[model samples]
Target: MSTVKKTVEVDVPVHTAYNQWTQFESFPKFMDGVEEVTQLDDRHNHWTTKIGGVQREFDTEIVDQLPDERITWRTVSGDTKQRGSVRFERVDDTHTRVELVMDVETSGPVEKVGDLIGSIDRRVKGDMERFKKYIEEHGTESGAWRGRIKPGDTSGPAL
Candidate 1:
């Protein structure tokens, strides 16, 4: 598995940054190669992405989440195998640092080559930068789900 970690500082409060991140369906607005994201529920979503001419669809489940702190997820069933988390930290009253860490396992030769060339790392970094710009421009989140979902909880988030 190849691991990529990236961080970006946004000109928003930790609440704003974390709230925007929770709106998973809006990811495509800033995430390169992401075509669509469907939030199936509070804890699950489906993603469609095309990178390097390869198209993939996947479903991910949020295993852990805490408002204004962190959100973690892993692929439940999909064309890819990966898990990741995003953390939000307050820099002050109006600034926040967003950190992302992901572990991905290359499936085929093309993906393996891309990983070796640091393409995955670059992509993730670019995504973070874009997100910074996006949130800064919007000045607020499009929507928010402040529910908390602890690992192993199947009932749902505590809204």
Candidate 2:
């Protein structure tokens, strides 16, 4: 596994930033490689993405989440293996520093080369910057999910 971490300061309150981040289904608007994201339930999501010219699908389970603080998730079963977390830090009432850390394993030689060249990290950081712009301009999230998920509850699908 290889890890990449990036941080960006957004001109928004911690709550605003955290709330926007929780709107996973809106990711396609700012995330370049994400084709679609469906919130299967409070703690589960289905992701369709194209990376390095490869189309990949995955179902992710939210491992942990704390309101206005952080969210961590891992792929339950997928074509690619990845686990990551996004954290929000309050710099002031209207300023927030967002940080993202991802651990990923490449599936092939092409992807390995792209990762080594820092393309993946660059893409992720760029996506976050776009998200900042979108949120600052809109002043709110497209949608939000304030639901909490317990560590071991797995049953029906409800977004």
Task: Score each candidate by Cα lDDT.
Answer: 0.95, 0.86
Across 1-159, the per-residue lDDT of candidate 1 in tens digits comes to 999999999999999999999999999999989999999999899999999999999999999999999999999998799999999999999999999999999898899999999999999999999999999999999988999999888988887
Off by over 4 Å in 2: 150-159
TM-score of model 2 (CA atoms): 0.91
Candidate 2 lDDT by residue in tens digits, 25-52? 9899999899999989778899999977
TM-score of each: 0.98, 0.91
Top lDDT hit:
1
Q: Which window of 10 residues has the lowest lDDT sum in candidate 2?
A: 150-159
Backbone clash count for every predicted candidate, in the order shown: 0, 0
C-alpha lDDT (0 to 100) for residue 60 of candidate 2: 94
True-vs-predicted CA distance for residue 84, candidate 1, Å: 0.5
For every candidate, C-alpha RMSD to the true structure in Å: 0.6, 2.3
